[model samples]
Target chain A: MRPDFGLLLINLGINNTVYVKTDPREIALLEGLAKDDRQAIETIYKQHYNMVQTLIINNNGSADDARDVFQEAMIVLYEKARSGTFELNCLLKTYIYSVCRRLWLKRLQQQQKFVSDIENVSETVPVEDELEAHGQRNTEFQMMEKAMQHIGEPCRSLLEAFYIQKRNMLDIAGHFGYTNADNAKNQKYKCLMRLKKLFFAAYKNNTP
Target chain B: MEEMQLLDAVERYLNNEMPADEKAFFEQLRKTNPEVDQLVVEHSMFLQQMDRFSDWKQYKATLHDVHSELLETGSIQEKAPRATVVQLWKKYQRVVAVAASIAGITALTISAIAYYFAPKPASEIQLLSRELANIKRTQTITDKKINALTGQASTRFIPPADPKSGGTGFLIDGKGYLVTSAHIVANADSVYIQNTKGDYFKVSTLYVNKQTDIAVLKIVDNRYQPIKNLPYALQKNLADLGEDVFTMGFPRTSTEIVYNKGYLSAKTGYNGDTTTYQLAISANPGNSGGPIFNHSGEVIGILSGKQTTAEGVVFSSRTRNIFTALHEIRKDSTNEDRIKLLLPSSIKGLDRIQQIKKIEDCMFMVIRY
Candidate 1:
């Protein structure tokens, strides 16, 4: 008897996707853009550009302005991905919206316009204040960046390979001469700790 | 199965690495054990964090390369022979002098125009008149009966005998380290905390944000009973537009915590400041410093401010700030944990709620009054 292809496809699809409802393939495509893949970037842009455009338009920006802001946001994402600094802490859509939102808000303020467009917007998360506070701590980001630079070569390389190179666990393991993927992961964790130690040391010294 | 093994299997399953037999076992486990199911969800979040970190590194590398290239090109030109520089300098001198004269003339004309068009400085009497008119307008608007009613209700929330009106805060560590608006608690006779169970404890020794409006308060009594199995919300990075979020705090009435639900309106940048993203949400005066949660009840931001005129334009300090603040308070904490906690919150559908509830259950709760 033949196996049910429909069931197989569903099962395969569910297993590969992070969230059951969202298209996992889209996420993969977005993830691939980290490798400087223009095709993947274009795919992501086509899929979610409307949402980003809407975000800007809703936030008191014109369509033309939205287009410019969206492009700028994409460029920033592209740069971050190329530099290995773009962390996928949120969904691609969310991250894109955030980038656009920040850009649009900045544009409005630079134009010296009252931010009445955002007047009715309701925030569910308290991210705004947090981002502001983080912005104010210029010393912390600078210190953290400096510490990251000072970390030992092996640790830095492992971190860069795993994070910046967008290498899979198995690939990272092979590149780093680890016994297996698990070992590579564990090594990454350890290296992360070392980075944190350096960061703390720098932060502490800078503090009065 | 043991928790570690269970977590590992869940991680494998999330990564699509589970063999048929293990996948079957995991699916079975999910049905029988909600705790294990929750563990899987939490572990998946860690995976998401890893993915994000990886992507961030990739982007950072690209930026670094661009900067290096720019520097190299600039340096090469700077190092060119002196002979070429002298020839170019001579050739450009006449053009440069003409251009400078034209620029100078344009600047003078623009400055003169600006001076001619500029409004005269207002006299003291004029300034006073304007101030009085603004005050009258404010009074007229606030005189509405609804405004009076709301004002009275707000006043009622504050105890007459107690000098300090309650503010917002969060629990750091197992200790009752709470943060709130400095303006709220700057003048207080006493500070107290009320847990989810309605138990109250006194607090003392507070820390304030360096420049912003946040203040931190530590529980005074060493023996004070901290809330057990508290639901500590993970402070994720931030919320995206259309992501569902909920805020819990005392609004006008201090008798009970008010829960308001809304989507992230906008990721805002204040006054051309590109460094931070501000969120517009629905918040009130009493909600300052209250935890803002995603639909899964993960604390994404701290409700800090609301638009002075409007009802929905609430502002928050990002979870990143809290992480940095916590780092400053305790240097021993790992950045991994901080990064994990500060990972941004995103919208997930209702089908994912079961997965999210498990994570929410692990959150530690801090109650303050």
Candidate 2:
């Protein structure tokens, strides 16, 4: 959850919050991401959300644009950290800022808007592999999300319960009202195969 | 049939359920079959996307709570303008009223949908079982048709039902004798065994026990040396459930020797077969004939197929059965001196890594041409 600033949401849009330096505590906090702790990431977002907002808003973007880019950058970091592919070469805040700046630049370029502060973004050289991995992940996530919408129910929920919630076969059986875990197991396989089919088909159509 | 096995293997590999050797084989497949590779990526992404969606909802809920607290405490550094507050309230009220009415309808619709789906959970198992049977029948018919047209090359394409399984095997005695799964070389006219050194030797199947599905082969190449006093021996006793064990195999057709360790998870094989014990290792098809060894390097069982119904459940034929089969093979007077009757393992009590190091040379791959 975002920390409440009371009526001070106005200050969130302001550019004066001093950037935080990476500390030992922050290292521990980033490590929490690898452990799949959401609270750590949310705290990271809470701290850096304002910096991202100021960057985007100052550079010909909207508050919504800042929010989206900031969120995407956080996801990028989250995935990298979780995969153990990231190294703390620089401060965590610096790393996230670079990602947001790069994303903002990409957006500006997509709309054919000239980016004035492109030099500032180029300073950190945001981890290339991380950026690419995150890009691929985002693309996959979006495609899969779209495919999920087209899928029929029960199968959808079954996938969510098993894959998303990481529930066991028996528990899933009980929740989904199957006769037995084995029965649910077979049904789950069919659902997964079908989901893969539908997802791949949609991905193909969408890609080119 | 080969295509089906490939798909199954790909699925398991994508799930990270394959042991090291089998995983290497799957990596090779990804290099060769771009379609399979793409399928893996798509399936993984699909699963990940679902997880991301779940997390997103949780995250948004937390964010909403934070937003409410900020509003309640008015701790925001600067108050939002009075005019902006009024305008926001006006906009919010409209949204809230619309959202309230939609949510009411949505709740009713959800309950109706839930009720419709709740009662009917029938025939899924029966349907899948039948579907599997149908696939088997179709595969057999296709194989028979291909057999009929073997002499003449035709436009029709028929895949082999029993696909090539590059399974594992280990030398039981130091005299070029090896034990592998019967199914690995079953119904095959020509079979070759290879080792980690890339040396391919002719495998003469001396005994094929179909009931227990264990095969004993003698490596016949004169150039191949009978490995000296072996460092490992087959266990005369059964492996207790939850005993620490490890195995090695040429899972990727001898690309690299691979080792995996897990505990014996069950006293009997799938469906409670007494001749085999179920291990918790993620053994794959290519690891079918690998040896399951105790921490002291005693060969306890033969590494076999994984149960498709669950993850991390592997079944291995008992070493005792392999010994029993060897005993039966040695009973003939003419064969008495030809094949060694009793092959006992001499190595024991070594650490895990050292045991693996010594036992790796005894491992072989049963490859079908």
Candidate 3:
């Protein structure tokens, strides 16, 4: 049986009266999404992906375009859910439709495919702040990725084994052929320093 | 060393692993020293960034897997643009006919105009792999005709079955895990991999990422014996430009392994695709999914395709993609097998001939049906 989110819903209700009318099912799904649960993602995709795809296809976009925009909007929703501060004041459908619309509009303007305003019967909420936060996080994630790529071999693998994989130093030592946990820890420290320098360098360049 | 110690202490304190007294002492030090306080704040932010970065990657990978799985299961469908184009063509059929007749009268000029306005980029590169299935189909047709005439069954070592596509694959893990080009086996009904010794083993697809053109397969045949270790290490770093690189593949009708030597010509593939490397190597239809080995015998890339417009210009997906693919595969809870990648380069300092001898044992012909 799925774990009950009744306690969570009650706590959220008492903490914020704004979410009193929000569906507990939506909250549970978002919580699952925050945890990166596969079933939850699949459920969301099955429910909302078609609606978003139809919206994009009707607005002078191909099926591939629909898939891309929908996935990016999903990422935006994921970022919001993972932040743990999102308060659902509207239906999940309306919010997703809003986010996908805003994203598709920006994409259209970029591609010079802007013909006219997209037609939508659904209600939309303001999501500028959410999109901005998502954009900033996306940039930082990319910078970190570039740094990881640049930091060559053993160093890259060592830090990843520790931080990303969450492997203990002793287990990592045996896996990477290091002599002892202290040796692995020392190597990890060096790698971490290099990664930080590269990451901050890219971060500074992007911001400035 | 001193900085390492400080960072370790900060990490312990941040993680709340420090004893109460030690934590209190550290808090007092942070209050007294502005630099220590700054260090704690900076380290905390950096660690948080790392954590979020890891989460973002995992989430993106899961999204990709989910998208592909849904596509396969037909939960979501991709609309083809061809249907609309065909309808438009039908509506303009008369106008097109008139234009075609007029163009035929001025064929030379029309040819020049068409060449000038052609979509150039679309035809620049070609996937140089897989046509053995067609050959097998034709052979089967002939064999059936002979059987109908002779009234006796043809005695062949291998059964007559339809192999959908074929390409080269190599063992990434000695315990029968193989990596090949995704396109070669994307829609295959049943996949089989054959060693150079003509021993065929059944395999199952474990993971596939079409964007990277990488697919991982695990041998499920009981007859196969696992090797102790792999000879070549998959290179994590990009191979240097102009480095001597050689590849072994089955690029011929026969089962014999073929070898070709070339140099790394560019850091990127055709159209500046960063995920792949361009090489000055001669590759043919059956060369896809072959491993491109550097001088030290580290597998740097997997030969994917070649530029059709340029002679001797081939491209191979970077080796690091395999690492990323394996990492994503390991994250799936349903998969119990832990795929460990061999890191040490045992073939280092070996001659070209000896290196090929050892590498050939790990190479297999991917048979898709």
Candidate 4:
């Protein structure tokens, strides 16, 4: 049997989920991405890969370049969702394109690889703060990555299930094969404590 | 503030469960107290980091699918061309050149696959008997050890050890006596015991029993001592075949302790060897000599080795084997101080997770060079 790649975990308590329109669907996609849902992410890739590809290719890049930009944008979106701070202020598709645009432009500038065409386009000029904030976010996110890889499970998995996946207390309890639900909660706290110790210790010690 | 309370407050603050007044108070504290401020930032970063990890895992999976899809179906029909066709025509030449190169790369890839599949001799296949659990994977963790101003605190990505050899061991006493599989240290020129906290201590072999395959070691440094009370009692009731059993060990050299669960699947060892029990737990290469604990946190067996062809059927030397060896060493008048260190565990009635917490600190990864 094929594994179901996504679990549609909606924190939206009210409003029955019958309407599979844009917002709820995006929320589901974001949540699915948080859950690391394969199909949801593939749908996203299929939807946006070409958009990013066309932009990069038109601006003197290749299909491979497009793939990288799209993947990178997906990572940024995934980071936003994983942070549990994602609110559907804009459509997911629109946000992805803008992010890809920013990323591609930044890369092109860094490498000084491309010429014009992306410049005169009336897309919202990304501000200094926005660029700086994105840079800061990327650096901090990278630091977090280093510290987390050093952490082993079930501490690692517990934290992921809670903060990233937003899985409820009981389901996490079952997943880790804990003796009971209460133990799972306590263990989650313990794991969090350990994570804080690991993360901050590495944070203070990390020069970058 | 107290450390535990500080941790508790950090949790409450992050979970947003603090009362309105408390939230205001904590925010005030965050301004005045640097520790609380650091804690708050660290907590948020931890959440983001954990989420990033989850995303990367799923993201990698989708990326893999896309790579395959692109390879097979050739770019999924280009998504209806949002850009103007005139601009696209102007851009198509450069893209065409890139596409030609990509096609050349694909041809090279197909040839590479053909070369990779070219088969050779049956003599290349030999059943490997040496069950060494060295960290085999190429480690991406660049920094070997994390150094604080005060001391060495973090050892990242299982520091460099002989890629050929490694094994597991557990602290039998607070004064630094450890019990591991004989095969781990029996052939080692130099041995280092790395704790879960990433502290490495040199260890000298105190004893190694060849037949039973149990070895003991004493930590070289005098300052280091583990938990005073051994986390598990040495309870050797091997009567029941189906008992809750678990092991904590470094199954691979590069990672920290891994915990696996299963039942005592059989009475005899491999090929009906009497000194061991057939545990249903999947004992990997590096798990040799790890303490096998029952649900009550009793040391029922010392995990030895697993058969090559079987899955989840590993052998663990019964606690009785260790006891018999200890008795013989006493009779032969081995150093009196050597026997003094081994102690019965004081912990009991703890469930699985609790047992793990207590026992995890007591286990160490033996990095042999």
DockQ of all candidate complexes: 0.04, 0.08, 0.31, 0.13
What are the TM-scores, per candidate, against the unseen true structure? Answer: 0.30, 0.37, 0.47, 0.37
DockQ, computed on Cα atoms, for candidate 2? 0.08
When sorted by DockQ, best at the front, the candidate numbers are 3, 4, 2, 1
Model number with the top TM-score: 3
Model 4, span B291-340: residue lDDT tens: 99887778888999888887778989888877776666667664664554
By DockQ thresholds, what CAPRI class is model 4? incorrect
lDDT tens per residue, model 3, B33-73 = 99999999989999999998888788888888998899899
lDDT of each: 0.59, 0.74, 0.87, 0.73
* Cα lDDT tens digits for candidate 2, B109-215: 99999988885557777888999999999999999998888857554232233436568888877788889988888887767777787667777888898777799
Show model 3 residue runs off by greater than 4 Å. Answer: A1-20, B81-369
Shift in Å, residue A121, candidate 3? 4.8
Q: What value does the lDDT take at residue B361 in candidate 4?
A: 83
In candidate 1 chain A, what residue range of length 10 has the lowest lDDT sum?
Answer: A118-127
Better structure of 2 and 3 per lDDT: 3
Task: Supply the TM-score of chain A against the true chain A for every candidate structure.
Answer: 0.43, 0.75, 0.82, 0.53
True contacts kept of each: 0.09, 0.15, 0.55, 0.30
Top candidate (lDDT): 3
